[model samples]
Target chain A: MALDKSLVSGSMTMLILKLISERDMYGYEMIDTLRQRSNHSFELKAGTLYPILHGLEEKGMVRSYDKEFAGKTRKYYSITSSGMAQLEERTKEWKEYSDAVRGVLALEVSVL
Target chain B: MMEEYIRILLEQIRCKKSHKYIESEIRSHIEDQIEENMSRGMDPETAERMAVNSMGDPVMTGTELDMIHRPQMNIKLIVMIAAISIIGVLIHSLMLHDSFLQPETEMISGHYLRDVIIGLCVMTGICFVDYSVIARFSKLIGGAIIALKILLIVKSLIEVNSAVKWIGYGGIWMSWLLFDMIYIPIFGAIVYKNSRQGRKGLIKSFMWMYIPVFLELLSANMTCALIMLISMTAQMYLAIRKGWFGESYKAAITALVSGDVATPSIAASVVKAFGSVFPTNTFNLYRDIVAGFIANDERNYITGMLRTINKAALLFGDSSSELSNSMPAADNQYMLTYINCHYGIMVGIAVCLLIGWSLFYMFRSLIKQNNQLGLIVGTGCLMIFILNLALNILINLGAFPIMECWIPFISAGGSCIVLSYALTGILLSIYRYKNVYPSDVDVKMPKLKLLLEQ
Candidate 1:
């Protein structure tokens, strides 16, 4: 099932940090990777992606710079150490919450 | 197509500091998106459209960007201006009660207080107005002021025996002095429009200034007229040196004096230009007025008055009461003399401090402005305050001819107070939008650059 935007939006910074931690990427690359990694289930619009990137940059959680890549100048964002730490904490919290939801769902299904 | 979209998006964004980086980033993002779509076998046009559409909405994105980048008010500048204005008004009220100058014709303090309130509201209103809007409609504004000034001059002419003063309906004296200052933004606009064309543009700007100078000369207010001429030239010099002529002022002057630059027929061309714009009868009248002003020997009258005022001031040591008793009524033209004599040297020093502080704040703000028009307008306002302060001081010290001029905010004229406040408001607006251009702008100030290095 597709995730609601409200659920996805709250984790935008975490998702962006997670993507950047793997490799330095620009806005379009990050959006594409997030969709492919989620099997086309999670799609962050350009409008949504850029603001989150900018917010992360502003908060010092990520840093961005312009560099030539593939014969074209692109602004690539990279995760900082702080961004990595936050990503780790967020990943752990997300795993516990999803596990709790799945346990409740399993109980309901067995009862049926 | 992507570039065009980005252009429109940026046009909606107000903050100039972030504009360049944002532009590059947006362009890079759009290209990457389009390329990704192209890899999926989409046509170039379709891929471009899809990339742009996926950006959500340009307006929404621009609004989001604008929130992060807005102009900031200089609080210190505002506080400094407020302090000076309050001090000016208090000193004005003190002048009214001193009772040494003359028996009061009307309660001027009440009128001044009312104008102060009105002026404050007007100032606030102008502060919110974008100065670009003022620049856009400058021609209409210039024309309207010219018409108003001409009408006032004519009205003053018809009311003989009260020949010098332009008295309004209730015998309240109208200040044609400050009215001329409204031309400053127009001067900035004209220079901005024509700064790059050639010597021809410079002459055209000078001709526009000459219109007011000629009119004020006819109205017999020579000091204000002279001040306008000097200030306009200063503004033009600043704009031109900033590279309007594509050369330095020294280079341009050298070219002119060496006969390398062709001289335009200033008088004939100006007259011809005026003829084309105005009807025949009005043109003839303007021609006669110009001819009469040109023919009159202003030097003799000015020197005569200067000698008389200087001799009297030197002998008496206090010209307000002593000079007025012996000679013709000194009137408010001798503001510095009146202040120094009636109030003591300390009060005079305080008044000077107030004026000096206000100018200092404005000068600092002027230096920080990034927009070209903001720089020009701020410079023009600085010239006005500087010239007024300097001239008032010289006239007070009997160092120069006594002429009718006001002490900026402290002067007890309604129109002067209101218009001076309004001018300050415009300066504040310039200060507010001062950084509406990128900090990386290469403004040419060769002399200043040299001084700073030393």
Candidate 2:
């Protein structure tokens, strides 16, 4: 099933920081990596990704530089130490949230 | 198809500085998507359409980016500047009212008010101007000012003792010496924005810095030359710290140390080269004149009088000894000492604190700037304020040699007052646009080559 639009939007910053934490990636690469990793279950819009990346950069959570790949100039984003800390925090919070939601749903199924 | 989409997106973003980078990044993303789609056996037209479709809602993205990059106003800085300008006017009025210091000529009474008014207006006007213009044309602007100074120097040589420093027309005069303070900010722009990358760029920036310093020395304005050297060197040190020239820290430090060590010899050589062309050894002549005054302290009228008044000054009220009517440039250069004698030592300290506080406030804000151009230009402005205030206060306290320095904002001199305001305005302009520019946005104006570089 496709993810809820609002759900993806709310956690977009964490997702972007998480991707960049693995390695420095350009804008298009991040979108493609996320889509394949999710087995095409998540497809991020380029328009959505860039604004969040730029915002994270402004907040010093990430830094960016331009690099040439295959003779094409691409603007690449990389996570800073602060971004790593943020990703860790957000990952912990997400795990707790999903676990609680699954627990409640299981309880409802048993009751029914 | 992608071009139209990108254009529409950029239209929604108000900050022109972010446009070029955003457009390129978005265009590349769409192109990458199109390549992937075509590899899946889709037709070129369909692949292009599909790629553009995936990047949702350009207006929304642009608006969100706009909100992040909008121009910011620094209200506290504006208020502080206004307070300082008001304090200047009030102090000048107080000086005018004092019977001992009141000038015999009518010209002296009205001049301070006129200068302050004009200054404040010029400052307000400058605040609205985008300071990026300085960065954009850093070479042209820096070249033009240096060219003007060289022209003035040539004129001075031809005319023989017809004041090279003052440029006057129709009863209005400006001291090129006072105006040279603007070069500090212009120098910052050239180093940060125009200079090429790495060691060659470093050498070129130093050359740009010394030309003015050399010109000032040639004209025998040691104080102006010294101020330019110290401030520009400080700026270069800052650029090194920022790694603008891509040099290792050790290499940068060595270059700075050697530059500082070499300056005095360079200055001495310039003085020696021009000594015969001029009537006297201008450098040593100034030194000897000042040394003679110090040796014969009782005969050195201004310093002797200031020393006596300072000794007699009370902590919170007027001193018993009156400041003599014959105090030279009493309204401008000696305004600080006059305040101590006429008002109180405490009041003079309060004025000093006001000026010091403004400097501290400005420095605090300046360091926080994310944009390189803003930081460089702002540092230049702050350097001028710090140097002028330190020299003026030291002279007032009889700790430094008395020269033609004026306390920024508070002194009653037309050129000094206006120049101080203009510098403050530039700082405010930098602060005003702080958020509007991203850290990596290229500010260099295109298609213009530096005349010197060619």
Candidate 3:
């Protein structure tokens, strides 16, 4: 099922940080990687990805540079040390959040 | 067609100065999207449309992009400047206290305070505007300021050696020196903006820089002119070192060796015109005083001022106040003396430290920016402030001959207050956008020497 953008928006930065931490990726590459890794549950457009990446850069959470690839110069964003720390914290929070929701649902099913 | 769509998106991005880099990145993203769709058996046209549609609302995206690249302000610098301005006002108030009960003194005091308010308002307004926009229209601004200086020079000639730098309107002196000093930043911008245009551009930039200096000298404000010249030359040096002039030396030599009648004739005419504009008698008079070729009477005036300043510096009490009370124009030419007399040597030291602190911040901000316009304008502002403080101190110490320049913010001139604050505002404006460019380009980092073993 396709997730509503608003539902996925809160964790977008965490997802981006986690993706880039594994390897440096351009905007289009990150979008493709996120879609495949989430089993096509999450898909990001250029508009969504570029602003987040640029914001990350402004905060020094991520850094970007132009590189020649596949006969075209593309801007690639790499996770910085700050970005890794941010991702770790966000990941822990998200796990706790999902577990709480699952626990609530499981309790409701048991009551039924 | 895809390019046009991308252009439309970028046009809405407010921070258009950095559009090229953003455009390339966005263009690559769209191309990749189109390729992905086409590989799935979609036609190129359908894929292109799909890719464009998927990026979301252009306006929203543009706004977000603009926010990401917007200029960030330095608040700490602003607070420091405001605090210094308040200190300046308090010092001026204290110096004027004896005459404060007089209506005329009270009126003058009111206007000085008002000018500071108005000047700060102007400064705050300038901070919001992009400095690149200001640099873009510097030619017109510089020309208008130069014209005003010319008019003032003519007026000063009519007044006949009054040494008055301003015209009185409603009892307030509107300082021409302050207006002329502003041309330094505009001249800096012109030099830096045209830095890449080769030898001809360099000559044109220098000509623009020379106009205000020439005008300042004609008005008999030697100290102000020197301050501006030093600032302009420093900016020019930075531009040249940055390779903005782009192989200018080779072009200059080639033109000189070849019959290049244009370059040689132009140079000769410029020198001739400048020589004619500088009056010989006035030049000799000022030159003599500066070189200590002064007559006995002039030497006496110097000695008298020196004796008063020395006594004030040493006595540090009622004796200093008594000496200052006896001196003519004690507050005007004897700035350090008055401060030293009333507040003691420690206060004077604190004032010096304040001036040094401001200069330190200006240079620190200059190093933190990579933009050529910001660099040049920052350097111009830095030198103007530093030189004005230096010249005033040197004159007060009897090292340099007395010339009509204010003690920056602390001195009692309405125009001086307005202009000094206005200049500081510009410095703050430049500092606010210090990081607009990328890190390497904006900052001048030292090279780390690497060791090599054979």
Candidate 4:
């Protein structure tokens, strides 16, 4: 659940890459983190998430490995350099988006 | 924990539903929720429940999601309209090219659009409108199907270019103007809905389909009629599993064997006319001996009379290409060639396998119930689609590689593509949106027969 909102909301895809940025996690784990990180404010449903993940995997934005962990073997994901680059670009865009939104909301409303 | 949730989520997807897209979505949401909860120091179990909860009732949520995501947007429709319209125009021009190939692109394009519009409107009317509304006119609908089959007779008689393709649309030779398409869909709906009671009802429902097909074959429009017959049979087979299979199939076979095709009055006359003629006839000599008792119709007799002239067209018709020598004695499926050309036969094979595997897993749950009828119908429909595609491609290759066999999803004829997709949407709407059984939500639901569990 510990995810960067600036990254997750703008395009949670980079967030996916960021998850894989450090280590590989399977589809389920990737989704869980996005939801928990958003404090239930942003629930990453399967509809939105899997297609992005699939797109990422299809584009080789990330790579997956199946390994035996705990008791069950799972398909874990890791970000490729392409994914990392995508994450960085998305993060920059996110920061800019947040700042712009903040600036707009931050405007003093002359209550007329 | 998220993984386990996904595993269970997959189980709940139910075979009757369209799970292709949403399967991934559900998995994503669960994972997203779990990660958030886990970071908050919630245990895996707590995280899992929280994630599932955030998914906001999978049924309602899935329906909403599909509405947003599935391809029914105006933009998509327009693109489809443009592409399909062009194809339709091309076909029209090709059919009439011998008359005038007026070397102008713009004029031809406009004509194609007209065909596109007709095809699209018909398909749209099928998909969007309430099937039940269409069902009420079952007698009229069934009659209309029979009527369309009869058109082939007209085609055979006034045929041109060695093919029984056109009906006289004023002065034009209208080829592949598929009015009979409404037959399979409307007939399928009627049979499934009407036969939802007892075996006799089911059998009678099937007769709705069979009579038209027999009429079609007799009219010598065997090709289109065969497609409808096969598809309807597949649909009926599905209805049976839905516990709606009536004596329709049996009735049809009996009617055919007994030489009775239509109403009782028609049946008696047909048998008599044929029975009285063939004292020394080679075929159906036995049927002729007993034909005094069994009944038949003048419809076939009438069609047989018509076919004498059409038999020549059959010996030399080319439905696809307008050129006299463009097609072969036989035509194959078009969709397969397109797939093979674009994706390669290898990839096409793989894609089919992937689809097959998912479908297999899907029915695994449904088949877990003992509703043999539902399983049979579902499997039969799939088989029919497969067979239609295969036969269409074979026909195409044997004659013209550029064929009209439709790619249900991939093909660009907006009308046809949309038509197939509507079925997928229905399943999703029922399973993911409505949740499990299509219910009268207020009433206690009867368990629909399932192949998996009793």
Candidate 5:
């Protein structure tokens, strides 16, 4: 997973866009789910994850809400239209990349 | 299907997380694990324990998980502190002008400048003195102030009112000037230590706090008592707001049991009330006080004050008047409302409030995000202002009534204001040079001790 740096990073970006496409997620929860899905393979430390989320929010990839619940407040984030469009583009790119790798692996044994 | 498993998952989170987000995330993840285990037929309680075990230890996890709270320092605050202390000292000096040889206007103005100089010195002294050392050995500093107050009370009885609030010899509290000096260190210590902010620490500071004021009040000075009370209130308010009084508010407050209040009543209560100073010696100077209390003969108390006033008038060469020696025989704080003589009291009180509020606001700003420095000095300034209010109200007007209480950089002349400024300067100087100002960093306390010891 560490060696497949592009896959890991792209997967995180995809997961965040998917989660926020439905509802805004806090940085903490977003990291938590990403880790659980990958079975602790992606240990997204808060120090790293928060900055990415902030950067995404700044770049119009996400909208944020400072809201309260159960007597405590949290800042939540959701995907913007630009984020959804980027996710569509990335998904297409990911499928193409994987198909190309698979095609290379499944080359027919013409000699056999 | 896994209701019991859900219950077990909730138990996994026992407050290990400091950050709210991490706590909930971990808790819900545990819930998910519990449900997964229960689908395979694990019991709810065992599933809960297993889930908690899997997440990691609560203590270590929580610390690593939570975000830290950091407050920033801003500009408005610094200017306020510098302005307040500087201006407060200048204004206070005007009242201390000694009209001996120079023209009255020049003397007054010159004395005010002297206050400014002394005030600067005080700022430098306090600013430079390592507060941690003062904090580390606050016990010694608190004890010293308490002792001085006791000594002054004994001396006041012997000298009767030579303004022994500051000085004393033998057992009499006549040197009001010296008696007032101890407050500089007493209230200073409050700002010094209470700013450290622990229940035990503040209590320790309070013990040093009331001793001198209590003794001063006992010497029959009403103004000092009021001042003492205000200082504590302001200190407590700020300390509590800053979360320095521990986690709970209950411990911050203690019983207000005054030892003297429990003692038997006497005519001197009135004398103490009006004459506004408690005698240094707890023992009666005149043998007839007990008999006098029984007979309700407080006439001598008024007469005693009159004789003292008459003496000051003679010394100052004021024209004689019978009413000059005695008040309207009222038993109240506004003892001077009828006299209307000291027109200066009105101006003094008004100017005092304006200046007092300004100083308090400024110091409050200076120490705004800074609980340590703010708490100590804020409380000190507050206590002094409390003293100011009582004096402003009780002081008899018409002519210049000799002030028996000290007002830091104001009211009294010579060493009074100058010494105050020097101490203030030292405190500010210590604060200026010391790295990690509020912390009890071991490096600075030793230097503070050396400076203070000097």
Candidate 6:
């Protein structure tokens, strides 16, 4: 099932930070990688990706630089050390919330 | 089609500086999408349409980007500068009132007030200017200032006294050379924005740094030359340490050390210049003159008078002994001493603290700047303020030899007042645009070959 837009929107920064934590990426590449990794589940829009990336940059959570690829300029974003700490905190919170949701859903399935 | 989309999208954003990078980034993304679609067997036109559509609403994206990229203003900095300028005006009026000459109090105060007003206006105007434009034309601006100084030096040689620092017409005079110190910040921008990479860039920046120093030395203005040398060298060292020129630290240090070793020859040349300006006996006379000033000799007595006044200065009220009205240049060079004598030491200390607090605030803001050019230019301005204030204060306390250095906004001179405001204006401009520019924004200048051909 495709992820809900609202759900994805709320966690977009954490997701983007997680992606860049593994490796630096340009905007188009991040969108592509994210889609492939989610098995086409999380298809982030370009408009959505850029604003989050820029916001992350302003917060010092990510840093950006320009490099040339295929004779065209591309801006790449990399997660900073502060971003790593944030990702760790967010990941722990997400795990707890997901585990609780799964526990409640399993109980309902058995009752049904 | 992509251009139209970008144009519409950019129209929604208020910041002009962010437009360049945003346009390029968005255009590149769309191009990548078009390529992907073509790889999947769609035609180019249909792919372009789909890519544009998938990017979502232009206005929403633009507005979101704008929210992150708006300019910022440091209101506290503005208030501090205003306060300092007002303090300058009041102190100058006080000095004129206490003057033994009693020269046209109204006329002189009016002139000082006018200068302060003009300075404040200039500061406000410069605050609105985009400082990146300076980076774009750093070379041209740096060269022009140097040329103008050289022209003035030539003019000074042709005139009497051979040390005419001012240029005047119709009874209006301006100390043109005093404004040359603005070049230090411009030099920072040049080194940061214009120089090429590696050893060649390092050498080029050094050459640029010394040209003004050389000119000042030639003109026999030792104080200006010394200040320029120290500030520009500090800037160059900063650039090197930041790896802005992409040179190894060891190599850069070696060059810097060699440069320092060469300074004694420069000092010798300065001494030689002074020797030519004064007779051999005058050297003995100069030593005796300095000795006299120290030993309270009647012929050179201002330092001794200042020392005595300082000893009797009260913490919060006027000193027991009245401020000497016969003190020359009391309104400009010795402003701090005048304040200590008339207003009490505590008031003088408060003024120093105010100036110090402003510098500290500015330094903190500059350190937080992500933009390298802003940091460099701002540092140059900060160095000037610190150096001038330190020298002026030291001279006032009789700890150092009295020179013509004017405390930034506290001194009572037209050019000094305007120059301080202009430097502060640049700092304000840098702070104002801190958020608008990305750290890696490219400031393009015309090619040297094209310029040469023209």
Q: Candidate 6 residues A1-112, lDDT tens each?
A: 6877998888888889889999889999999998998899998899888888888877778877676788887888888888899999998888999999999999999999
What share of the reference contacts is kept in model 5?
A: 0.00
The better candidate by lDDT, 4 or 5, is 5
What does DockQ come to for candidate 5? 0.03
Candidate 4 lDDT, tens digit per residue, B350-420?
A: 44454444334434433332222223323433443454446553433332122235433333343444444
lDDT of 1 by residue, B56-101 (tens): 7777777676654466676886787677678766766765655453
lDDT of 5 by residue, B323-393 (tens): 44354322122223311222333434544565566446545443422224434543564456456545544
Q: Choose the strongest candidate by lDDT.
A: 2
Query: Compared with the true structure, what per-residue lDDT tens digits does model 5 show for residues A2-65?
Result: 4365557656676678767876776656766777877877765443454455446534577554
TM-score of chain A, model number 4: 0.79
Instruction: Give each model's whole-structure lDDT.
Output: 0.67, 0.79, 0.69, 0.46, 0.48, 0.78
TM-score on alpha carbons, each prediction: 0.58, 0.84, 0.66, 0.37, 0.44, 0.85
lDDT of 3 by residue, B1-454 (tens): 6776787788787766567667777888888889999999999999999989878777677778888766667777777777778887787676567541345445555466777787788778877776667776777788788776777655555555444356567866676666667778878777765765787777787678666666565544666666776677677767766666675655544533332334334434543445334434345445445555243556447645664656557434433555665544544456665667666666766876887787787788676454557778878877877887877776666666666666666665567677777777787777665434442121212234521321
Worst 10 residues of 4 chain B by lDDT: B435-444
Name the candidate, 1 or 2, with the larger lDDT value: 2
Error of 5 at B21 (Å): 27
- Rank list by lDDT: 2, 6, 3, 1, 5, 4
TM-score of 3: 0.66
Error of 5 at A46 (Å): 9.7
| Chain B TM-score, structure 5 | 0.48
Summarize candidate 2's per-residue lDDT along B1-454 as a digit string, tens digits: 8888898899998988668777888999999999999999999999999999999998998898888767667788778878887877777776676666544322454588898889989888988888887677878878988898888877766666767678878998898865589889988988886434788888888788877887777777767877888888888888888778888878877977787667656766766677556543466655544573483654456676677777778887767544455455575678777778777899899998988998899898887666678888888888888888898887777777666677888877788888988998898888777666655557667663664566
Q: So what's the TM-score on candidate 6?
A: 0.85
Backbone clashes under 3 angstroms, per model: 0, 0, 3, 49, 73, 0
Question: Could you tell me how far off, in angstroms, the CA of residue A105 lies in candidate 6 after the best superposition?
Answer: 6.7
lDDT of 3 by residue, A24-90 (tens): 9988999999889999898787788888887887777887655679899777777878789999999
In model 1, pairs of residues that clash are none
Query: How accurate locally is residue A83 in candidate 5, as Cα lDDT from 0 to 100?
Result: 87
Proportion of native contacts present in model 1: 0.39
Deviating ranges (above 4 Å) for candidate 3: A1-112, B1-43, B46-67, B99-111, B151-164, B167-173, B248-281, B291-297, B307-319, B328-333, B432-454
User: Comparing candidate 3 with candidate 5, which one achieves the higher TM-score?
Assistant: 3
